[model samples]
Each structure stands twice: as structure tokens, then as C-alpha cells.
Target chain A: MSELIKNFTRELPDWKPRVRPVNLDEATEAQLDALKVTPSNTKVSDYVLTLAHDVESLKIRSPLFNAIMYDKGGLKRSERELGAIGASVLNRCIYCNAVHMNRHAQLEKDTSVTDSILADGENAKLSSRDQAIFNFSLKLSSCPPKVGKEDLIGLEEAGLNIEEILDLILSTALFGWANRLMHILGDPVKLENNDS
Target chain B: MDALDTTTLRAAGLKGSLSAAAALQQRANILHLTQKAEAAVLRPKDFGAYNHELRHALAGRICNLNGDQITADQYSGNAGTYADLIDPGNDGGNYDLEQLVNFIDKVATRPSDVTEEDIKTLQKAGVQDPDIVRLSELNSFMAYQIRLIAGLRLFKEYES
Candidate 1:
């Protein structure tokens, strides 16, 4: 029995790091240039680089990349980060949740609101549109198959056009895949460690 | 175009090809939000199974043509594979939604020293109506099963 168990364990692949965090100074100038356009500082810059590299290493590109780079239907930086945070929260990715929550705070200068949203998504004091967006993101992150006409109707009620909804779905799906990859590969590193 | 149609036509004209792209983007966003709403209702521990179910449902292709009388094996090959979407896992699986629901109900209904924060955490982890109404209540799960039967639906529509 022990031998069978050992064989089963051995058949499982060894763990490997999909992404390693890199320092800002160590990143290429091209990377720094990319960060500059997105209104990032050293800390945000390093995090983005690490996240990008990790994503690339995983053989995945976050839908967030498009939201950031192409401005896909003008998805703001805050909203994009909110989507990431929502996914991390759903996936129970402590590392991602902490990282995204902190980044949102830095950018928005309102930790309390972010904290509230993380706490109670539906009743958070966000604008109707933001609440709808967050609500939609939460549902997508947690239970995708359940999505239906009513949900779409709610988005329409929230005044989001079809294009905006598509962008949100892409972002949510990208993060959903990402959260799974991160969870299976390894728990996120601590937020303190994530920074350096 | 009539007066109202003129405004509509003008907006359409201005939107041009962007409308198609925008439509695709909007669909993607709705998918994302739906996932998030489901996640908000789940507990942290339940997330794994929830993830599995979401993927299974999204990927499922089976349908129940005559109602609940059908058994899994009775259906012609792969006919009801998609049925797994609504059914919870077998005897011993960590990702069972029923188990998660039971657990959440216990916590939500019980009296304990649990703080508001703790309750909130549990709430955040649970899967609620906005997250799953379509699948469980509106029979979107059946629709998904039908799509699988027809092979005409865009699977990526669920992917986001």
C-alpha cells in the first residue's frame, strides 16, 4: 500500500515557480516605460512587472493586460484593479487579495471603501454602476455557469452597454483562470514579500 | 430613418464597427460579474468546488429531454454529461455545493461568538442568487446542456 501511494505521489509533477517577483531597478527600460504610461510608481511598477512575468511564465496573459494597455473600452485602472481584487477574494487568494486591495487603496486613496467592498460587495456604498459592475464581477468570479439573461438584464439596467459587459467578462475570466493557476501552483506569497 | 430612428441611426453610425467589439466586451463583462457575484456568496473553503462546478457547467453539454426520470447511463452516449452542472459531487468530494450550503446555513443561522467580520467573510465566500439564479432557477444549465447538444454555442461566451 505504501509503495502504491509512493508511486502515485511520484507520478505527480514537481512544483516550479511560475513567476518570480523582480525589483524595479532590475526591470528593463521598456518595462519602466510601460509603467510610466499607466501612472505607476516604483512599488506598483515592480508589482506589475512581477505579475506580468508570472503571468507570462504561466503561459497566460491576464485580460487585465488589454484593459490596461489597449484601454479596452476605457476600463479605468481602478475598475480593472477592482476586478482583480474581486477574483482574488473569491478564489481565496490571500496574496492576490491583499496585493490588489493595497494597490486600489494607493490609487484611490480610500482604503475604507475598498475594505467595505471586500467585506460586503452588494451593499457597499459604490455608485449604482460600480455596484453593478462589482456585483457582476463577483458572480463571474465565483459561479460562471449561473450567469443568465437576468444578469445581463441587470447590467443593461445598470446602463452598461454590451461592449462594457464583454470587457468585464474577459477580465473576470482571465483572473478566474489566473486564480486557479495560482492556487494550484502555490499560494500567493505574503503581501510584504510580494512587494520586494 | 424617422426622427427617433435618426437618433438611433446616428448613434449606430458613430459607433460603426466599434459596436460589435463593444458588444463582445459587454458580454465578457457580464460573465465576469456573474462569476464575482457567485464568489461573493461562497465561503473561502467552498471556492475550490465552486470553481470546479463553474468549469464543469460551462463545459457541460448534456440535456434532459423528458425531465428528471432519465438516468445518467440511459441517455445516448454523452447526451447528459452536462447534467453534472446542477448535480453536486459524489459521496466524498470537497467541492460539493450542497455541503457548502449546509455549512453556510449552519454558520449564518447559528448563534456563536463569530464577529461581524467573520460573518462577512463567510458571506463573501458564499454563492448567492446573482451568482447562480440563471443556472439553478432559470434553467440556464439546461440551456448550456442544449448548447452542448447542438455544438453551435460559443463556449468562450462563458469564459469571459
Candidate 2:
């Protein structure tokens, strides 16, 4: 019998993260300060909060994520999400996959495109532009060297200027780190059963 | 890596201001920490390592990227090296940090595969919880940095 599921991202799980995150009360002053600057503010994501152990790194990492993913002006927010989702999928971080895939769906005008990419990026009916981004992202996430100049050239050919090219690179790079850590730090999910 | 402001670089060849590059330079703040973090892990007041080869199988494998040689070579000169630890396939030379490094590498590649047993192994190797977190962070950071440069290399190498 096929299992009935309501939502893939949100309804998926209330699973526990592998490592215990610092509770709001347990956070040091520096960690609290770092949390403040992040997009979620005191509502820190498990991934961001785990870095509270090394507040200095969190201070550095948080702003970098903001600039690359949220600061705006290079790639469209949706495009950045595309790169993020691609890397997350390849790295096998279900936590990141849930977060970024949902974001991709939200930012994109059509959820179907995001859904298609999620199913099978290689066969997804993405426009050449997104295809370029997806191909570059997949290559970078798996075997970085297999990627080369021609890859960026294809992006350029797809009409992305050099700046957009760089934006794609940065977003993809940030997620590389983000996915790697998130995988180790914990899984993401909202548990069912009234917080049981 | 002359540390050119991304704004200036964009102005030279690119037509428009790519805010992400400037944001990356001004806001990402990782470049600033890269040196210190690199030191804390690779050098650590111990031996020096320039490239990723590490003269140690564990660290080398942990650092393994697509273009193993090129990826290994990527960090040379910029990060500074006090130890001649670049010789490939050599045992960790003089450090006993291999166990933790290998464990962190395993976790980074396959987090779900990690179990309590892995943590126990690290503990048996005399690794503390704090050190484990640090090692895990370093592994993740390396993955991030390597991917960034690898992607950028395309920009630098591609004539277009």
C-alpha cells in the first residue's frame, strides 16, 4: 500500500537533529549576537545555532550566507535557490533539501518547474539558463574538477553575465558548506503529535 | 588572488554591478577567517602543510576533491605553510590527529551513515566532544572552500 503524504517539505518529519543544538538560554553572548544578525534573528535554525559552539565562525558564516543568498542584486532569489537546491540534492542533505527546495518553489513563478528539477534534474525541462546552473551545480557538488571553463561559458551563452556567473558560484559554494555541516549537525523536521 | 574588490573587477570586464561579489567580499567574511582556520587545523603550531596532499592518507582522503592534484594544489602559497607536509601517501608524518580527521571526513561525506559507534571510535582515540565539533566544522568548511574555488577556477580559466 502506498503511503499517503500531505507535504514533502513541511509534513515530512519531526525528526531529531543528530547533534544537540544550543538552547536559547544556553547560548553565550557572542552566539546570541551572531544569531541576531542572521536572517532568522533569535529564531535561529538548528544549523546556525549549532555553530554557537564556535561563535566566531558563526559570526563570519551568518553574514556570508546573508550576502550570498539573501542580499539580492546578482542572481534572482529564485536562481540562488536553484543552485542551493541542486547542491543540497547532490550532497544528500535532506535537511537542506527541504529548506531550499521549499524556498525554490516559493520564489519561482511555477512550482511545477521546481518539482520537475527535484524529481530528476538531468531530465527536467528547465530552460537552457537553469539547465546551465543545474549542470554547473551538480558538477561542483559531485566532482569539482570535472567542472571547467566551458561550464561557465555555457552559462554566459545562456545569457547570464559574469556577475550572475559569480552569484551562482557563491550561492552554490555557500550551500556546499551549508549542506556539509547541516548533514552532520542534524536532520530537519517538525514532529507531529502535538509536539510529543 | 590579488584581493581585487569585486566591484572593480566587475567594472573592468562585466557591464553591471554584481552585488553578490561585493557582498561576498564585504559580508561573507570567510576570506578573513580562512587564514586563521587553516592555521588552526593544518599547521596548529605543529608541522606545516601547503597543499592538500597532507603526506597523510586520512587528511588527504578527507580533502579529496574532483581534481585531486589540482584541488590539493589550490591552497598552496596563499594559506602559508610552515611544514613540508605536501608529500602524498606519506603517513600523517608526526601527528596523531588522523583518527578524528578521518571520522570527520566520513561524517561530511555520509552523515546518515554515521552512528554512535563512530563517536565511540573517536572517543576511544582520545578525542573530546569539543574537538569533535571543531573537526566536523573544519571538514564542512573545507568542502565549502574547495567548491568555491573550483567554481571560480572556471571563471578564471574560461576565456569567455
What TM-score, computed on C-alpha atoms, does each candidate reach?
0.42, 0.73
Query: A47-87 in candidate 1: lDDT tens per residue?
Result: 34443332222111333344332453545566667766665
TM-score of 2: 0.73
TM-score of chain B in each prediction: 0.23, 0.52
lDDT of each: 0.40, 0.59
For candidate 1, give the DockQ.
0.04
Give me the TM-scores for chain A across all models, comma-separated. Answer: 0.59, 0.81
Report residue A37 deviation for candidate 2 (angstroms): 11
What ranges in model 1 sit over 4 Å off?
A1-72, A121-125, A189-196, B1-160
